[model samples]
Structure formats: C-alpha cells, structure tokens
Target: MTVTTQPDYRCTPSPLHAILLAGTVPLFLGALLSDIAYYNSFQIQWTNFAAWLIAGGLLFAGLALLFALANLIRADRKAGRPVMYLVLLLVTWVLGLVNAFEHAKDAWAVMPSGLVLSVIVSVLAVITAWLGLSNLRSGGAR
Candidate 1:
C-alpha cells in the first residue's frame, strides 16, 4: 500500500497588511485632530506635516493591500470574501485621500466632510483587517 500527503494550499495574510489596516484608524484620527488644530490656530505646525505623512502612508498602504488581495484571489479562486472587503477599503481610502488633500490645501470648509470620510475609512479598515486576519488564521477559504 502507498500513502500520499496532500500539500496545504492555504495562503497566509501579510503582516504588513495587518499593520496597515490596524494603523489606519489611529492615523486618520491623528490627521483629523491635526487638521482641526491647524484650522483653529491658523498656523502651520508639525501636526500638519504629520497628518499629510499619515494620509500619504495610508494611501500607499491601501493600494498595497488591494494588490495583495488581488494576488491572493488570483491564486485561490475560492477566496471571494476578501475582494469585497478590499473594495470597501479602497473606496474609503480614496475618500480619505480627498480629505487629506483638502486639508493640505488649507481648505477649512472641507474639514467637516473630511472628518466624516476619515471615520468611515477607519471603520472599513478595521473590518477589512479583521476579516483578512481571521481568514488567514482559519486556513483561508473553503
């Protein structure tokens, strides 16, 4: 009798992706606060720069996450859930980016809208990250 072992086809979630997702909320909050400060004080401070940096980082991270998810889906056709999560993440990221740009331009009128977008982005990022991490821990899709 001969016995054969099957290879595990499970794909592991990238730690960088998790980090990005986890950091999104805090970073957006920091940006929002900094934007508020800048507007209230009417002065350019370190917080302004920090907000821009965080927003730029998030934009890049969002793109990276989308790419990673796309690759995973391509490799495992069964992994469909993550696609929705990624899409939601990307949409929110774009909204956040728009807010970030408005803030950078010192358009205080847009701050309220940006704040709302940032909150939405944070929620979506958290959900997406949780789903990705959970799927990876559970050995991925069926």
Candidate 2:
C-alpha cells in the first residue's frame, strides 16, 4: 500500500484586496479629522469635507468587505481571525453608511452624533484594516 499526503496551502488576501482594505483606514481617519475640525470651528465646509471623506471611506470599506467575505468563504478554518475580520468589516461598512446619512443632515444637526459615529467608524476601519492586512495564515492538508 502507498500513502499520500495533501500539500499545505495558506489563505491570504489578494493584492487588490489588500489595497482596498488599506485605503479604508486613511479615508476614515480623514473623515474623523474633518469631523473634529467641524466640531471645533463649526465650519460648514469642514462638514462638507467630512461627508465626502466618509463617502470615500464607505466605498473602500464596502469593497474590502466583499473581499473579506470571499476570503472567509474560501478559508479552510473559519473560527478565528477570518470570522472576526468579516464581522468587523461588516460592522464598519454598516456604521459608515449610517455616518454618511448623519452627515447628510444640517451641519448643526450633525453635531455630536455624527462626530461620535465618525470616531467609531474610523476606529473600526483601522481595526478592520489591521486585521485584514496582518499576517493571519491558515494552512493544512487538503
């Protein structure tokens, strides 16, 4: 009798996925900064900038979330970081959408809530990006 073993393979994000994931952090961070400026100066322009930045962040995070879902589906082991990453990305994308809606309101009305949402979304984006880009590997015999 002959014995055979399956080769070990690793699951990781593609280059494009990494780029999209990386893009979310900066855009969200920029939105957070804009929200801070708007809060401090009460400048409507700052709010406008924040809205645009949040939109861009949402776009990137949405794409990254799709990639994360794909990866989660493809991964052999889905119990650890992969599941957490997908959940975080989903939460970030959803909250980002809500923040966008909040920003759509009047500049003065966007205060407090919008800023709070921005802060949360920004932190989530950073965490999602970090989780997506880090060296998380799952390898085993197929």
Find the candidate with the highest lDDT and give its number. Answer: 2
Question: In TM-score terms, which candidate is top?
Answer: 2
TM-score of 1: 0.64
Clashing pairs in 2: none
Cα shift from native, residue 130, model 1 (Å): 1.8
- Model 2, span 1-142: residue lDDT tens: 9998655455568899999999998998999999999989988999999999999998888888888888778777776677888998999999999999999999699999999999999999988888888866565422
Runs in model 1 lying further than 4 Å from the true structure: 1-10, 35-50, 136-142
lDDT for each residue of candidate 1 in 1-142, tens digit (9 for 90 to 100)? 9997554454555677666666666666676666566557755663465457556647655765776666556664544555565666677677666766655644455456655665565566566666655654212334
Clashes of 1: 0
In model 2, the runs with Cα more than 4 Å from the true position are 1-9, 139-142
- The 0-to-1 C-alpha lDDT of every candidate, in the order given, reads 0.60, 0.87
With candidate 2 superimposed using the best TM-score fit, by how many Å does residue 116's alpha carbon deviate from the native? 0.7
